[model samples]
Target: MPMTEEQLKGILRRFDTNGDGKISRRELRVGLRNLGLRFAGFRARRSLRHADANGDGVISEEEMNELAKYVSKWGISII
Candidate 1:
């Protein structure tokens, strides 16, 4: 199923630590940990970079939004 606005908003809320409507690498890792996926040290940095946009070395809100679509496409929901 496609990503619902509410679901996407929830995901953003989970990562938007500063309430600034944007997510940094630290925030993304927090969200990943909440989802039961954890990495450490260099691995964490690499993972975040892999998802980053603009090569600034952090996943921004735009990247997070794009990622939400992928997450919803792969996630299974019963209803």
Candidate 2:
């Protein structure tokens, strides 16, 4: 089943451990590992580099869509 944008955003939001309304590198790694992804640390680094357009080193709500797109490419089953 294809994931909707809202669902994707909600999942991304859950990864915000600090609840600061942003997804950090460490949080992203943990989230990916939770999804059973191999090399999650490397993936998180790449995702941060890709999704963090402003180079802030974190994925904010404004940058979430990019994160969603990147994660989707990994074919994650967010069911």
Candidate 3:
């Protein structure tokens, strides 16, 4: 099943190591790795590009929501 917004927020918070309310590239890489979705540098960049809707080089709450939808649509399980 797809994650709820609250569930997604909780997961994102775990990755927000600095508690900055955003996920930086480093954090994203670490988070993905923890989720068993390791990616090389180029692949990581591509993933970030796809999710960074504002082109701010980080994933904000809004972008994360969009990402959650994509993940759900693709049947990607975070658990």
Candidates' C-alpha lDDT:
0.59, 0.88, 0.69
Model 3 ranges with Cα > 4 A deviation: 1-5, 40-43, 73-79
Put down candidate 1 lDDT per residue, 1-79, tens digits, no spaces: 5546567657656777777776666776677677665352444466456556677766566666555544444353412
TM-score for candidate 3, please give it: 0.69
Ranking by TM-score: 2, 3, 1
Pairs of residues clashing in candidate 3: none
Residue-level lDDT tens digits of model 3 in 5-79: 668657755877898988788887777677776453544566678888989998888788765554444345545
**Which has the higher TM-score value, candidate number 2 or candidate number 3?**
2
Model 2: how far is 56 from its true place, Å?
1.0
lDDT of 2 by residue, 1-79 (tens): 7778779889778998889998999999999898788999999999999999999899998999898888888885454
Model 2 lDDT on a 0 to 1 scale: 0.88
TM-score of 1: 0.53
Model number with the top lDDT? 2
* TM-score of each model, in listed order: 0.53, 0.89, 0.69
Comparing candidate 1 with candidate 3, which one achieves the higher TM-score? 3
Better of 1 and 3 by lDDT: 3
